[model samples]
Target: MTEEFLVAKDLRKRFGDVPAVDGVSFTIRRQEIFGLLGPNGAGKTTIIRMLSTTLEPDAGGIEIGGRSVAEDSVGVRALIGVCPQELALYPELSARDNLVFFGRMAGLGSRQAKEAAAENLELVGLLDRAKDAVRKFSGGMKRRVNLAAALMSRPHLLFLDEPTVGIDPQSRNHIFETILRLRSEGMSVLYTTHYMEEADRLCSRIGVIDHGRLISLGTPAELKSAIGPPDEVTLEQVFLNLTGRNLRD
Candidate 1:
């Protein structure tokens, strides 16, 4: 049986009387890509923050790699990496510089940071562009750099929050291939995105949340089978059926 790498149970968080997350429970198995699908304002970000050790939960328990988040935030930080939706690079710096900086932040020595930067830049297909200023790169290139920066920590679990938001198809595909490769190498991921097709193609299992509560949880096929024949039903249909068609904006 696959081991559970991350466990979250009855997670509840509230801000100024507004409940951002309530009674959520799930487990991510080792090396699994578990996707969390939710509408805007549905608390996906909140959950990610809590699990990543940035935000403490109002009520709940979180364990990553058998270490309690509340007890070992430092340990948890070492085991996970986060690539947020927004770009987190210094525009004026070279791609290599940005990666080395992040590597240092993750506690690597200068030599180690530079070495990891080179390896990760190559992994993201950006080794050839490593010396270029980030501000001069295309949106796709910047996105790839963002991913490489996150890997400087060599995290066992990666949190990808909308990692492919606005990149070109080639860059998007590169990110996809990189993620699959990581999974094959025994890395676990908690991915959150609004792109239904991405979740369909990548996630081994998915959890759909709305109004701060999880409404459904299943493999893509199982979720699709809920609304129609698995082969005939697209994930978009299942998502809209569960979360409705109202514009989140």
Candidate 2:
């Protein structure tokens, strides 16, 4: 397999007169965790949408596993699993049912869907609560189920958008461990989050986006070193220095 699992070139997207993504480009390699860090309205979400084949770019191009996103969206979708920032779950359904439903949506057979649901639930430490209604579960528990649903596709690349947002420390740590384990198992991940420390700990490389453009790209150590002494510099410091402290809408 090629080292590069995902590639985008000069991607540009405009909504009306506003350019949401302006000439953004990056690549995610096999078994690598690539972080995309930006404040609100940085266009990372637009980038993710284009990468995941949910939204077509008005300009530029994208290829995942050598298949062009515009020409082969079906093929691209088969190789990717997207865990969106928003919860995509049937809250009234049991956790097991929710996963099974998503598995079926991913094109698994009924038997395969059930089996995958059980496996994913176990993977997320939610097997014991599989039959519980999702509405009764805590936010952390629901987020775990969301991750499990995304895995039903058995994808080669995963798009995780703010996966640990608003979760407890235990849930966040569980997610961190899960992402690391997936990478070790050869899954390429495109991760986006507002948490600089999380990116610092988990990403092999990080690309910082601001005002709809890629402003910086490097390993966490390199990025820190760019701002100050590596050991003395924090990712948050680097982020603030690059993006400034102004509040984003």
Candidate 3:
């Protein structure tokens, strides 16, 4: 069996009177890509933040490679990389500079950070624009840099929250390819997105979260089978049936 790289048990979190995450539980195996599928206000981002150690869960346990985030947050942070839905970049800085800064924060030496930053930028096909400031780049270019920054530390576990949002088809495909390559190279990924097609294309298993609770969990085939068959039912139909068609604001 593949070793579990990430584990969450009865994870719970609340904001004010709203329960953002309630009793969520799952495990991601090494080299596997797991998708968290949900609509807006479904608590996807809340769960990502908790797993990345950016936000503490109000209750429950989270472990990354057997290290508890609550007990060893620093250790957990070092072991996981996160690319949030919001672009976290310094618009005034060059992509190289931005990556170097993030790498340094991850404990790389200044010279080593710059070297790694260049390599990562190249890996994401942004080497030509390495010296250009992010303010002058397009939305897709900025998103690429955002992902490169997260990979500076070469994290074992990666959390991507809607990484391909608002990008062109070419850029979106590039991001998808990058994610596939990472999993092939033995990195465990927890991806959160509302795109059913993306989930069907990449995830080994998907967990559907609705109103802060897990409503369903299974492989794409299994999920489609649960409703019927791939020819008879689509992932979007299954999602709608489970989550309902009501709009969430």
How many clashes in each structure?
Answer: 0, 0, 0
Q: Pairs clashing in candidate 2?
A: none
Error of 1 at 61 (Å): 0.8
Query: Which 10-residue window of candidate 1 scores lowest in summed lDDT?
Result: 1-10
Q: Candidate 2 regions off by >4 Å? A: none
- Poorest 10 consecutive residues of model 3 by lDDT? 1-10
* Residues 140-193, model 1: lDDT tens digits: 999899999889999999999999998889999999999999999989999999
Which one wins by TM-score: 1 or 2? 2
lDDT of 3 at 53: 91
On TM-score, the leading prediction is: 2
Off by over 4 Å in 3: none
lDDT of 3 by residue, 29-114 (tens): 99999999999999999999999998999999998988999999999999999998888999999999999999999999999999
Cα-based TM-score, every candidate: 0.97, 0.98, 0.98
Residue-level lDDT for 213 in candidate 3: 99
What TM-score, to 2 decimals, does candidate 3 have? 0.98
Best by lDDT: 1
